[model samples]
Target: MQDTTQSDPNQQASTTPITGGEPRYKNILVIEDEHFIGELYMRALTKAGYNVKIIIDGPSGLKEAQTNAYDIILLDLMIPNMTGMELLKKLRDPNSTPNLKSKIIITTNLEQADEAKDEIEKQADGYIVKAEVTPKQLVRFLQSLER
Candidate 1:
């Protein structure tokens, strides 16, 4: 099995101020089927002083999301077991589970039509096209959410 825990070496060098007096480590969950993309996110987010966990499939990712409180969730539209949209709906449904407060961001390469894009925009906190943003940009975006 591939080791899932990966962190960037320059994380300590980050200039972003740790919230409060001490560093507040935010928890992040990444639901992406692509190993390369997952690794890239893990490294960048970790470098930005966040604790991140990665799940490659939707079912497992959904379970994890339901059971734990994450500061952010990076979800891909396509994956094994269930689609990202399905998982997002479940997570957002208050009756479906308890403690589903994570901010979900759709991160995908899939191009959506106008209607689909509008629906996704309504459901998710943010939508990021994978090709448009680099790992650093992702981290910076997440930081903006802290304010």
Candidate 2:
């Protein structure tokens, strides 16, 4: 059997199947300001047997992400209190916050210029436009991440 718990600070998740066909990443954190979208993700992900938590603002999301060890973080760009880019900078900066093991995936409806988009993609594990994807599609994406 593979070891699920990570000893390395840089790698993301406790990625090993426990029993049956359960996914490696069981816990997920969603940072989104839109109530409907957050709820939709929570509902779909929970139903799929993954634990999910949703934060409405970037500050709270950053704080929670810093303090806890979530397997994945679904971040929105246009959020209250702070921007996702700012949060990404802080989270990815080893000098500011070290030993962050969560996989941060950018989930947003906002469009970015070529250079900006390249930068965002560089910092994050994955990027998905919220307006283009559904809750079920997001769940599938998460599952694919485990592979």
Candidate 3:
């Protein structure tokens, strides 16, 4: 595995909903190996005024997630270099990685058994089936998370 993280130069500042007539910034990290999906998410999220970045593989995703800069992390289960579940475990482990501030959400089309799904849900802040959410809807979903 290599450190293949590519942080875009267009990375915007964090954004926040109006509170006290002031703007706050929020950073979102999307970990999806699929290029099209990742770009779709990036466009939607960036349009919504979030500082969004996309990492296309598990190792880079994991490295970026550990930085504690992102307010939200949208992760895919199937990724190159490593599995999302494995990355999630590391992120959640207090000994291995502690005080992570990002809200980790699992976004994948992979179907799992009830037991497996439950287990993933237990480890992640939220889970969404990719097939069920359009790019616009994903932004809306993220808005709900902010509230």
Every candidate's CA RMSD: 8.9, 5.5, 10.4
Best-matching candidate per TM-score = 2
TM-score of each: 0.82, 0.84, 0.81
Shift in Å, residue 102, candidate 1: 0.8
Candidate 2 backbone overlaps, count: 0
Give the Cα lDDT of each candidate: 0.84, 0.86, 0.82
Which segments of model 3 are wrong by more than 4 Å? Answer: 1-25
lDDT of 1 by residue, 12-34 (tens): 55564643222243899999999
lDDT of 1: 0.84
Q: Candidate 2 — what's its lDDT?
A: 0.86
Better of 1 and 3 by lDDT: 1
Give the distance in Å from residue 6's predicted Cα in candidate 3 to where it truly belongs.
37
Clashes of each: 0, 0, 5
lDDT (C-alpha) at residue 85 in model 3: 88
Q: For candidate 2, list the clashing residue pairs, or say none.
A: none
lDDT of 3 by residue, 59-138 (tens): 89878877657888899999999998888888888876676877889998989889879878899989999999999898
